[model samples]
Target: MKKIKLSFDKFKDSTIYLNSSKSESNRLLIIKALSEKEITIKNLSKANDSVLLKNLLESENLVVWDAQDAGTSFRFLTSFLAIKKEHVVLSGTERMKQRPVKVLVDALNKIGAEILYLENEGFPPIYVKGKINQVKNKLDIPGDISSQYISSLILIAPLLEKGIEINIEEPFYSRPYVNMTLNLMNSFGIKSAVKGNKISIKNQEFSSGSYIVESDWSAASYWYSILSISDNINNLTLQGLKKKSNQGDSVISELMKSFGVNTQYKEDGIVLTKIKLDTEEIELDFRDCPDLAQTILVVAAYHKIKLKVSGVESLKIKETDRLVAMKNELKKIGCDFYEEGNYWILEKRRREIDDELSIDTYKDHRMAMAFAPLASKKSMIINDPDVVVKSYPTYWEDLKKVGFIIT
Candidate 1:
């Protein structure tokens, strides 16, 4: 229950180094397990989520995993354990249990994997007993929901005798993540295909091979938010992102364009420079990259820009009830956010800069990190600052590199 107090600080021209990407690390962990050749990954993410996933994969015995607050670990491990034929009780913190797993469980059951919800139906605190002997070669799961479930099944698909045939129920959100899973799997020598919404995999043993994870595009979004809010652009250079990235959040590059941050591709990573602001009201869909919703929402409110957003239904089941968190936290900062059917509206109003803003993170990493950039505009404090450990453990340290004041 640690709290961090942050104050407003102007960005002075400085060189900053950010940690590696957790998104890539988690995706790679599944690939490494499926690889037939011994694989070594470099520049892996140091986030607690990545660390937790690595430890769980290496653990032996009666494992009662405390995944902390990482939803990916929870979802991925559920599928991983089912395939291993091991008896494991997978659970998480109170917030984690509240997140839904029923969508994933039903899919696994259809594939002849035996899984039981220990307590609430469709939520966590799940029990995965020994594996079922049968494997259904072809199955259908909704793709419009969390793609973590799809990745979970894809990771263990190689080990199945019948392999897998996944029919995604809709056009799909987070297609890049599913593709990232397939791309990583191919790197490990197991090829899969997606035609329309139908994805098919052949049961081939994972051949071990080495692969490197790309830095996180999702983490880079915070820097974009900070640059948009700050008048100084000379103080920032984000490293390890690609101009062309498999990460769906790569759309952040184009999204930030509306906020006046121009991204430049370098050999090592991407560099962001602030540009002129657009006076037009902003409208965007978060269906593909729902995680970026909070960061974009905060930036829009700070800039006094009117915003309309959709494709955020998944927010309700994330690390926290993000829609509710945003609604409450934004109220604290003198702005209003409300859902009008499918669209979310942000009404902008200028407030006194001195009105001490204290944000409640609701155990969501994005909630804490997304709001942290607002410190550039005015001094603010975040409750449970440690919540960022779930995704980006070095978030506060990286903020310091950009000249943020933390105490």
Candidate 2:
């Protein structure tokens, strides 16, 4: 396995410009294609996952697409290709195959899609023979599972003979992501309405227009973490982000405030400034913004703050079991981490942290980047550092710009 050692000479005041949101970019790409209208998209994400989605959508005469570890691309394409009336196979990396797609496939099949599992009953490597007839327009899907499935189906809803109505069962997670999908759909002239647990989309046409994606708030979490744990107050500017964003991860700004990071909205983007720490114990519910959980946990661990986190049940099904990964990895840094029922707790250990800790990424991009901020406190080695390319391709480079030495 390839690894990189990161150490900081000194934390410097710097301005970092983040790439566009991959979440928004991927959704727009699908809407643009479904519209069959010529639309110009500006400031698309440079992440490998978004790039792969774009390439797959533009490619012709392709039989199979290996989505690697991009769960969004895999799920989004599964529905997108199902409605295209083509014979294609969608597969992914080894770990990706372990991620379940049965819920999505079953729903698509009920809607007249021909999707068969090539290997496991509830996993990847599925054969998608496009459906010619619409059998069902209404679906009952569990809300606790991945929201990508719902977004995938909803993105193709307009193309169906009769638009889709999805009844999301109670205990919903990532509601903001579903809202993000609907909001993006609205931006393209497709209208959707949500009443209680049901979301209804009509068979309307998408309008052709120019879309400019906002900067990724998820990617900015690491920077917020860096500022949270820094000893010296630093002024950091992140460009292209908005005070009001469709992305759900925008909650990072408020969450980081407890850790002493204050945010100011500027004309171009937002600026981060370190302030006084006010809380000794922090508690967060991550149901709507699960992506920020890891970064917040790492910050809490480093700052020796008692943290209680809930609504992270979905972490088990991500690119890796993030809760388990964080529990195992944080132990190496002398942290007491455990989960009780729906709540996970992190506390500092009596023992001193190891001088040179080696973190295993578990093939999860968030794992690699979330723990990277710890290097500002102590030098550490990260295994499979390239995993960050899946979401933030320029991660290491961006860290380098702020005086992180990677070798």
Candidate 3:
């Protein structure tokens, strides 16, 4: 669908079955590949990225792998290919080609894998010549780049001759994602440890096991946005979420509390109930859970909450330049968002809501999903609404369960 219009005054408490996490799913898929016959994955994500990775991993006799717009797939596949010693080219969609993969490539080359960029020097569309006769394992890398780069290297460390040790520089945000990777590897019988900024993994074989991916907290953030600003007090049961999750975005449960949404953890999932809000300002750091920046910004703007957030500069290299996209879009709704010093601040305006609000998705799934919740406060049109298929395929339908009107 090119666009969808959303509106709802109120709806009954309902259950929404969240899909499994694409982050965990993609990692487990790599772990499975390493184990070969020793592992099985349950509830793998249906996100386009995970689906493409699954299909490509299962395909045989293929020399060229096209990862499309799936950035995670390309990075993970790059490492996977290097370890398998496969001599082939890994390419992706136009936008994915633009995303930088050189950090991982350089680290891989240092450890004896030959990877060369076929297009731009620091980006994708690369030729992989597999593992070579060289010996190197310790790498010192900057922590500010994508966490996926750190995780990509960690995932392949166990197969190398000397294993690997990574020392991440300070000013590191998004540490939770890297932790999730190590935790997942541990579950598969791999031994790892982190001392200060140094992450060390010893060479070992993956043991036989099964991994169940939890419900995506990133996907659940949209629901948190929905409940936070909806016209009335509505309760939503987010199925499959847990009180304790390794996923960093699970912080949404606590963050939404600032907006007066209480989370009650249940055996089957999480239930969200809204209460009265009296807060005017919130200061947060998105460094660890950058994905929630857009979703939380929407609530802050709607409530006229003064928001001071940091660690979101990384959003520039995401599906789009989210910082610029958000700045441009929030203006339409009368909120002024700009960076002051180290913090990006959102100042709410005292104004009448336009009869209808129109939101552009910028081809970024989070942008579309984050603003759709505004319908609970005002009817809005979401251009490119289907971009949500990147992570949450049933997002609109799930919103419908909570009485959101989409046309």
Candidate 4:
């Protein structure tokens, strides 16, 4: 395993430009393939996840698509391949195989797509034989599981022969991502309507046009963590972000304000500056933006802010068991973190910070990036720092520009 040691440095005023949103890029790739007319996408993400999805979609003789722990790729591609006329196998890394796909598989199977698990039940390494017979046009799926599964089915909804009507059960997690999918489909000339828990899309052909992906708000969360815990009078600018974004993680700007970080939107991007801390205790429900949970948790721990978090039960099935990973790793840095029922609480303890706390990434990109911001407060070594390539490939490089010493 490879590790990168990061140490605190004097806060520097720097402007860091971020890559395009991988979430938007992956959806656009799928929509582009479904469109009969020519479509162009600009500012696509350089993240390995987007790159892998793009490559796999463009491949001519693809027998096997190895997503390699890119969950979005696996879920989105699973639906994309389910409606095609070819036979393909979708598999991924060891960890990806452990992530559950049965919910999405059963949903697709209910709609007439043929997909069978090759190894374990409710997991990946599945064989897909695309021949949609249109058994059912309506699907009812539990929204608490993963929004990617919902987005996957909806993105291909217009392509289905009979179209599709989806009823996402209550207690939906990551609702904004589902909205992003529908909005992206709308941009491509497929109109969808969401009434309460029901989303309806008719059998319409996608229109070709140009789309420019916004900057990744999820990637920006780490910078928010860095600014939130930095020393006095710190100001950092992030480029290519919008005040209004389809991405749900844009809520980070408001959430970080609780941690003494303020945002000022400029024409090009936004600037984050340290401000007065508002509350002693913070309670957040990440049902719509679970990706920001780790960044928030780490910052709250560093500041010793009492935090109560809920709506993260899905974290157990992410790239790794994130909730358990947080419990183990945060303890190494002098914090007591645990889960009670549906809530995960973090309360700082009076313990000395380790001289050199080491964090294990567990092959999860968010874990690596989320904890890297902690180096702004203390010296730490992040094992498998390269894991960030899954979404934010330029994470460490951007950290260096903001005055973090990585060696």
Order of all candidates by TM-score, from best down to worst? 4, 2, 3, 1
The reply for model 1, stretches above 4 Å from the true place, is 9-13
Clashing pairs for predicted structure model 4, backbone only:
none
Model 1 agreement with the true structure over 308-345: per-residue lDDT tens digits: 99988889988778999999988777778999987999
Clash counts for all predictions: 9, 0, 0, 0
Global local distance difference test of model 3: 0.88
Candidate 3 shows a clash count of 0
Which portions of model 3 show Cα errors greater than 4 Å? 132-134
Each model's lDDT comes to 0.81, 0.89, 0.88, 0.89
Off by over 4 Å in 2: none
Which should have the higher lDDT, number 1 or number 3? Answer: 3
lDDT of 3 at 297: 92
lDDT of 3 by residue, 1-407 (tens): 48888898467657889989999999999889877556989999999889989999888878999998888888898888998846799998788877888888898898888889888998989998766444888999889878898999999888887999999998887999999999999998889989999999988888888888899999999888887887574788889988889899999998888997989999989989997788898799999999999999988888889999999978988888899999999999899999899999999766756767888988899999888888887888999888888889988888887787888
Q: State candidate 4's TM-score.
A: 0.97
Query: Over the stretch 199-278, how does candidate 2's per-residue lDDT look in tens digits?
Result: 99988888889989999999999999988886643878999999889999999999898988999999999989998886
Return the lDDT, model 4, position 276.
90
Error of 2 at 29 (Å): 1.3
Give the lDDT of residue 388 in candidate 1. 84
